[model samples]
Target: MLRTLFSLVISAAVLAGAYVYTFGVPGSVAAYFGPQQAADSSAGAAPSGRGGGGQFGGRGGGRSTTVVLSPIEIQPYQDVLRAIGTATALRSTNVMAEVSGEVTAVNLEANQMVAAGDILIELEARNEALNLEIAEAELAYARETVARYEQLQTNGNSTVTGVALSEARLALSLAEAKAGLARVSLDNRTIRAPIAGRLGLSSMDVGDSLANGSLIVTIDNAEALIVEFELPERAIGILQPQQVVRAMTPTFVGRVFEGRVTSFDSRVDPVTRSVTVRARIENPDGLLWSGMTFSVELSQASAPLAMVASTAITWSQSGASIWIDNDGAALAVPVTILYRQDESVWLEVDLPEGTLVVTEGAQKLRDGAPITSADAPRGRNSAGDAAAPNARRDTAPRAGAPT
Candidate 1:
């Protein structure tokens, strides 16, 4: 009986395999088991019909990305070279004492605007005045002696050599008197401004003993400021005197100071390979000061070129590019940047005039991918209005289309 049971079990297994092969698993299972178990088995299998395609569907199904576009147009763009520089006074000097003496007066105030020949300081000159008086007395005595000598010579009371000697002595005394007067004038005790400018802080005050060449004050002609900067030696070919320049400083943001290139170094620095350039800027309001840092920009002549918003340019492993909207499809166009300004970038590309280029939402695009214009009206695609119910129902059969 056990042998018979084992043979029967083997036969049953073979029959089950034959049934599965002939009618398929679900059909064979329905034939063997009740319909309820077959239904459960079918439910556990991969979904069928409308729901078979899962979340995003198989390959080749993605929603079109929305983007904003701007048309490429020709614009006049100026090529600019930028550099950092320092603002300096047009003329600056250290006011020093020509002769040493006690400081008797301070005639200048800190930050005072002075004119040329204006007295800035004074020193005691009483001794020089006394010396001048003594020399004048000596000169007067010499003239009297010369007159007496001539009278004696005319009256034959003295020899001609003696009279000639007296005349020579008198001439020497007159020269000494003139020298004394000049010395007194030289020691006039007043220090005057050599140039018209604004004065810095005075180094010596009243009663301060000053030595010769001691610094009295500093003066700067700030009305016309100079901005000095360095540029590559190659720029020497383009640089010229009286070229326009614009400069900006942190102290005056958004305010551009206009200037002209006044001079450049005769030789380029061997170590830096750069040449020094100086530009003269007007400072009528005296807003600019010496030693202040500035951002200098020198621009060449303007040229017509294709310009786009800087945001529109994108970079990838393939270098710089931009997305062009070609009939509701994104086309990546390679570009070469020629120049960049604050908000615009000039590019050299093969795109035609008025070609629409994506500015916003560009990163979500790929080559030949369908795109929807962000600037389109609400609930509308790039083509036109929203699709009708029948059209959406028709598209449902396609992969990735929402049911």
Candidate 2:
């Protein structure tokens, strides 16, 4: 009978200890049955109505949860847009022959710089030159005959009829037209650069025959490069002409090319829901090349936002919020999370910069819950500033204090 009674008492004691650990001992029971001493040795130094045994609910006005604090910072939020692009010369074209003939001379070497109207290639024009000579001879004869007939008519010669003089003038006009045509044909045999640029490789040699419109070389004006890229439709309103942009190429590691937006496609691509954007970058050093791939970046800055430690935020059905220390109580202020980076989160809220926010022990807090700092009495917040009200005053250790 004595063993059975002892077992019952031990079981009751174990259950009571578990209850006290989980929900904390009730204020009246702890005051009456627990320790009779103050929880903090320096309890007399605390302000009126503030108690040290609130966590245990022993003869205190209300429970005060200990929390770590950090001050919020106002930081400008910038969104960076990245996309892949293709580089091209400001102007590019394939040089081709205008007339069919055997190549007589190739004046330009591969990758040679040429100016507008600079002769790049010459084709066989022996027959054309001969034709032009013949036309000029006939034209000279016709003009001499007309001059003689007019002189005869002016001299009152009977053999010089008005009809004959008129026919001679017609012949002279026909000869002039023939001569002009011959000159044009001869000029076409010599190919000249249409635009000032550097020339690409050409397979033609002195003896090679070229057909009309056959590609002889390629020319590119790379003093400036054009980079074409696509941006999603969501960036339409934000992107505008002349906006600053930066580009990098894998070929040149750590090199950045600065450019500005030159134009945008008139319509968004139906399949991709994106718009093509073009930027012009100066290539003074000739480092950039056509057909090179580039990685483009555009940065857009928005309004300033309140930045806080990610651990300071709490989520509920109503939305996300952070506990602000208002006087000695906790105030849950609603906020919209704008951006997140590593351990920091930028919040869109009306709260001013440098607001004290609870970083630790947030789970134990509610609206208007009394709070105390878990840091040293003079602990500095994340912003390197001291918070008000909830800042601890007594540095002396207390019973059941958190490590």
Q: Per-residue error at 89 for model 2, in Å? A: 0.2
Check candidate 1 and list the clashing pairs.
Answer: none
Q: Compute the lDDT of residue 336 as modeled in candidate 2.
A: 95
**Which residue segments of model 2 deviate by more than 4 Å?**
1-12, 19-24, 31-63, 145-166, 378-403
- Which window of 10 residues has the lowest lDDT sum in candidate 2? 39-48
lDDT of 2 by residue, 130-246 (tens): 999999999999999999999999999999899999999999999999999999999999999999888898788999989988888999999999999999887787798899999
Tens digit per residue, CA lDDT, model 1, 242-301? 999999999988999899999999999999999999999999889899989999999775
> Which one wins on TM-score?
2
Quick one: how many clashes does candidate 1 have? 0
lDDT of 2: 0.80
